[model samples]
Target: MTTPRRAPRRAPAALLGGATALALALAGCSTPSSGGSAAGDGTVTITVGDRPSADQAAARAIYDRRVQEFQKANPGIRIEPSETVWDVQTFQANVAGGTLPDVLKVPFTEIQALIARKQVADITDQLKEVGLADRLNPQTVKIVQGRDGRTYGVPVLPYAIGLFYNRALFEKAGLDPAKPPRTWAEVRAAAKAVAEKTGQAGYAQMATENTGGWMLTAQSYSMGGSIESEDGAKATFDDAAMRNALTLLKGMRWEDDSMGTNFLYNMNDIAKDFAAGKIGMFLSVPSAAYQAVVINFDMPKKDVGLTAVPTGPGNDNKVLSGGSVEIVNPKASEAEKSAALKWIAFFDLGKYINQEAAVADAKASAQDGGAVGIPRLSPISPEGFERYKEWIAEYVNVPLENFTGYTDNLATVQLKTEPVKSAQEVYAVLDTVLQKVLTDKGADVDALLREAVATVDTKLARAPR
Candidate 1:
């Protein structure tokens, strides 16, 4: 069965466009008057974003229940739920308008840029005092932190790109679906088998939009390539790791004849094809694998399988990680900030530690027919995350065993964030390079790397610090 696709997520907003947004935020924001004491007086009122819209009946019901429960548990803290959520286009405008929720959930990609732009608050001390400092998933923490070691946001759900494989194709190829490839050599063999047996694209890639560069970076990391300098000042991908990764792709496409003829693919398009069984394996997150491919694409539940991003000769074994994180408004008062942290601890962080809350959350997901039991990179210790998973195990709807190859190794692999300076711009440039390499048999990898690096370096030089 096939289903129509849901609208793709809004693209990340251009870096601070429109003079009015800058002018409004730069002019200063309206501050919320502090009514309650900073020390747990029931008087502090805080606004939180990401309230489920009324259209999302099941989710909204759970959200309302949680809000009421939260307000009751912490009487001294009054909670205000905002329908205002993150959108790339209007986020900065909201920031500029000073109309942002005291606590807003934003993408991991925005954390560094927001910090660099002075759009979010520095809550290092507050997080430390609240004991979240020690417990935060160290891997996810790296993405939100500044060079000074201050964190701008608290990661709510972190995920690493994994190989989303079609189990039916694997079975048809006489390969083990649960045991996904660990290295490039293994991937090559599996791709060959899947293509030869199923007459499908054994391994496809996201080669359009900025996603092309995004996946390329991930593949490059598996081969130990760096895209930029530590200070986010220069290009660093013109090396062996970069070439080796490209060479491997070249072999898969031209030599082994594994990848299919179609080269144009964005994240959404590829998910649809993967779900339709036209493709065997691709890079994606659990949400994409479960929601986009399985739920929306109507793929067989058991046919969808996953494993960690494959590793190569690159920088040990590491995966590129990303997810949503909550940040506080810079204009919020000290009491407001404290109250905001309390709300975050209660909402985002609380679910993992509180048994009732965990079970309720999972049950809500199950009731909503949302995919439950999708393994992911935790924003806390892997062990703690596993325990939380067990707490809600009864509600698990997806096949957990299929994801073991990815989840079991989360702690052992190094989690790498996107390029620090002009990350989107860098990806855009690399997108062209990737297209060139895949489309032209005679394309020179070294020349493409040097040209792309030069372009990225120039953009970095011109970027605002």
Candidate 2:
């Protein structure tokens, strides 16, 4: 019944170097004696994760209320909750310690691996049972399924890669903060101006760990390139588009001296610096960056301006899509699994489909001083989300307009998925490539890409078919 303090947002989980294997999907050890809907006593107990911790008092209050409300509606289910959140580094340990929450959220990056390890339950039947099989978003469901066509998780929060910029820096550099860079060329120009005029790192990059590769992938997608070929069996970054992307970074760092002194920033490093106004423009989605800025780094909320990923010359403005999925633990008892599904349904999906719930949740978030109405890519149909918006209209608190540049392209921009194989490994290797290119004046784009291709191909060959 007591809440723990919230840690600063855990977006750095993206930069973790290795796959968590079976651990990432584990809810606990072995199936329980109790079974779903068929428990002899007709009662089910389940453990859920991401309980807001003590750090978010208002959000925690709302979460607790929702749990009570859910139990009231589903009289047969009893819930045990934890503040345990999904973090890649602790994943294996959590599983080893037999503490993995029965129903927890995980990122899209782990879906394929979870399915391969059979760590998560196949929730296809449950989806059908709950009527969510049809209501789920089609595009995201692809990311939630296994190679055998079974559903492993339910996609909840999907986001597109966007350019995160310091609006105050833009104004100081004599640039229009409202009009962010529309193309890579514009980004280069803006970096130069911010560097010379403001004497700050006009641009920054997450050059360490998997983030280097992650950001590179986003850049490649923006520039109409991909790190892997369509078959997902080989490396494919040794081309002009990718080469051009790195070349731009090189120019900004060496020619313009626009990038900051730090060449080893991961998500955490970049976020702290970006939030402190030491950097101008970088790439990230809004939520994580905003959390770090306003909540962690203590930056003013208005300073965080976001825009869509700057486009490559020939690409039609494609941005990488990402989000977490709600997956049930494979080891859970049938009853526990069923209870977990219901928890997910009521906790996440309920807000989207139910008018009063949406309004109430939004109001609670606003009261918690949480950012609301920050536009994001959703896992529901556009129409469904629009209707949900109507319910929360009055409680909208986040200055959504700060993200006009990012949201303006939502209707027209294309959404791209992560590479199918060895994404973490590929990104880890790419990290070195970004570091070398950004820090080494003579860094050869062709040679670096060639070396990366060889490394990535070796890793991809080990990927599960």
Candidate 3:
């Protein structure tokens, strides 16, 4: 309900180092309950997490109002809002201690492992009963399924990596703002033009805080390479696609001199610079336009433009994707689980299917100085999404025409999830390789890939089987 400043844009959850201890702790307790208190008179009470903090008064007010409305509409269920949120460092402890709310949101990267550890509930039947199963995006929903093909969580806030450009820069460089680059070659030429004409960094790359690896992996995928094998037991990125990807970056940094002087960029630094008009183009989700350009840095909404990540020869137009999912307490009773599902449907997803909810949310966000109409991967079915968009059309504030390059190509670009095993570790390893390529003029791409293969193979060996 809030401006979506950061929840949907958070980096992947860090590696769960305490997973073994948490599993042991969970095993010791036969049944875990979210303390979803249920009364004998057929009334159920569920505790939900992710209530906005008090400092976010406007968003919090909307959330609290939704809670009250949900309770009043469904008198059979009472809602208790909790401010608990997912933090990699504290998540394991909360799960083991049974301190989590009945329902909470977590990143997609954590779903597979959570399902493996039996840390989240199987909500397949509840979803069907609540009529939410068919409403969801089938492709995105797969991320929350177990090997047995059962559901554990509901996908929300889905996003695919895309190229975000500064329209003002594009115009200043004598390029068409409506037509973004669709291939790597075009991107290179455009970056050079922006640099030569505007005296700004034509392009930038994220080079630290594990984002270096993240963006590099996305680039490699776009060039038709993968980071791990099918079962995620081996490193598989030592190939020509990855090599060429790095080679391009190396050339951009040293030969073209278009990437600017600063080589170290995490999510925040990159967003900040991009908003300040120091950079021209970069890879990120469309949410960055709202979170970075408008809300954080006060960039004019009309100046931001978004398009699909450019494809390479063998890419088939696939782009990396990730987002948030709502998981329920594995220890909850059936009644509690049902109540939790209903709450999720009403509070998290009401906007997608209900016109009133959609307009109310968008109006509030816009009025509160939050960005409206930023493009995102639809979590619901296509038909549902189209209707939702129509409902909010009047309140839409961002420049939709500037994003036609992405929205028009959305149907063609495929969405790929991140690696399934030791993802953070793989990213950490790749960060060094990307940094080397960008910062060291003579960095050897082949040698870097070979060394990474050896290091990542070792990481895969130590990962839990």
Best by lDDT: 3
Off by over 4 Å in 3: 1-37, 52-65, 82-84, 87-100, 315-317, 460-465
Instruction: Note the clash tally of each candidate.
Output: 5, 3, 0
TM-score of 3: 0.86
- List candidate 1 stretches off by more than 4 Å: 1-42, 50-69, 79-101, 113-119, 128-131, 147-150
Best by TM-score: 3
Of the two candidates 1 and 3, the one with more favorable lDDT, higher being better, is: 3
C-alpha lDDT (0 to 100) for residue 359 of candidate 2: 62
lDDT of 3 by residue, 222-276 (tens): 9888888866789999987788789988988898988998898877788888989
Give the clash count for model 1.
Answer: 5
Tens-place lDDT per residue, model 1, 1-465, is 001112332111111111112222222222233553334333677788888799976666656666665655555566788898877557778987988889988776667878888889888887875567777888788888898888888998777878889999999999988788988888889999999999999998888777888888888888888788866889898988788888888888989889988888987789889999989889877665578887777888889888888888954656887777899988877767776776677667775755655666676657656677777777786667778888889988899878888877878778777787677889899889888888999999999998998899999999766
* Tens digit per residue, CA lDDT, model 2, 310-377: 98755444688777789987877666766676677677677676565566557666665666677777
Worst ten in a row by lDDT for model 2: 14-23
Backbone clash pairs in model 2 (N, Cα, C under 3 Å; residues 3+ apart or in different chains), count:
3
